[model samples]
Target: MNHVISVINQKGGVGKTTSTINLGCAFANLGQKILIIDLDPQGNASTGVGIENNERENSIYKLLIERNNLQQYVKHTKIENLDIMCANVELSGFETEVAEDKNRAFILKGIMDELRQKNQYNQILIDCPPSLSLLTVMALVASNSVIVPLQTEFFALEGLTQLLKTINRIKMSLNKMLEVEGIVLTMFDKRNKLCAQVEQEARKFFGEQVYETLIPRNIRISEAPSHGLPVIVYDKYCAGSIAYEKLAAEIIEKQKKFNFAA
Candidate 1:
């Protein structure tokens, strides 16, 4: 069964794109056929996976507006098991376009359902925009699980509360199977007292929802998008790459338990 997961955060700087791209790559490295869907207009996940947004012909925008088939939008990545549904600036209008559609919230879910029935991927990782807009609602409706990438900062926690509330609302109203897969702490700097304090407080509140692996603030991760490559491919030995691999394992282990229960 394909496990569809979304990396979501209402806060912009929380590393949602970074986590989605790297964790998708890491899962591919473990021999899973992974599809990374760039649901953000910024399309950082597209660039992170080496898909040039400037060259996109059919993007997630088309998928949302035209109900484009998932196969038509999939672009191959340099990584073996990783493919991407690229997004571009055109996606900025997607929310407005779908705003009035009665089934707008399930647009993405409908596309993904068709793809899942086709059985083309082992995992689907969606990179949600940093908001509770229609796009995020669509992604949440499409996904079975959500991994919230949070920054170990004061405001990040507050944003997380709002995101969790939105997820709860979605679960109650749309996708009943939706669940919090895990929380990943990102942009962490061990040398900073603020980072430590924030992480401790997050653990106190989120507890088991937080992943064991913490992504440190690493320049390599920030630089990789400029080169249109995931941090793992840009610098395999980097701290950010290592953290994502650990996170991938954590996710896979949880999925394994779920599969056994099923």
Candidate 2:
């Protein structure tokens, strides 16, 4: 399926941007053409994947605000099969600027509709901002499914309960087809007892809704963004990179199973 998956978490520091970058690249390495839309105002995903501030001439801001040709906004990354729609601080003003537009929520959906028809990429990953604002709403409205990164730290599950409620509300009203593909536990530290406890509770409650692959807290993952690259590209042998690779493989296999059943 030519699916659009938004990597989202309302709570910050849950590895949302990190997952979007590394996981998208992992899928690309698996030979799937991928497009990453940096929907975050912070634009961490854009910076993490090597799109410098100077390179972002036609960003998501222009794509949404200017409503020009979407093709011109899509920038091919150094990665072989991955492209990006960059973003920066200018995107923070989009909400106030489009305040009077009655159909603003549907703007992203309309743009994605054209892309879906093209079927140029196997998957499109949207890096949503930390809050459930207009941009996050737009991503949710446009996405077929979401991949939530649940941090294994204290109060992580508490935040997820609220996020799930938000997802349900959006599903019932905005996009009836939207679904949570699965929850991937991130920042897992085996040394921390709390991390393991959190994982156990999540698996017990969510069952198959949580992915088997867990992303450990790694220095390389943090360091990659400084170099404007994904952890997978910076150090393929690192634990964080390996986990994303496994996650990508699992996602492909799971989709194949569902397709066969259908």
Candidate 1 local lDDT, 183-219, one digit each (tens)? 9899999999999999999999999888889999999
Across 26-82, the per-residue lDDT of candidate 2 in tens digits comes to 999999999999999899999998999999988899889877587999999999999
The runs of at least 3 residues in candidate 1 whose Cα sits more than 4 Å from the true structure, single-residue gaps closed, are 258-262
The lDDT of each candidate is: 0.87, 0.90
lDDT at residue 72 of model 1 (Cα atoms): 80
| Candidate 1 lDDT (Cα, 0 to 1) | 0.87
Q: Model 2 Cα displacement at 204 (Å)?
A: 1.4
Query: What global local distance difference test value does model 2 have?
Result: 0.90
- For each candidate, give its TM-score against the true structure: 0.96, 0.97
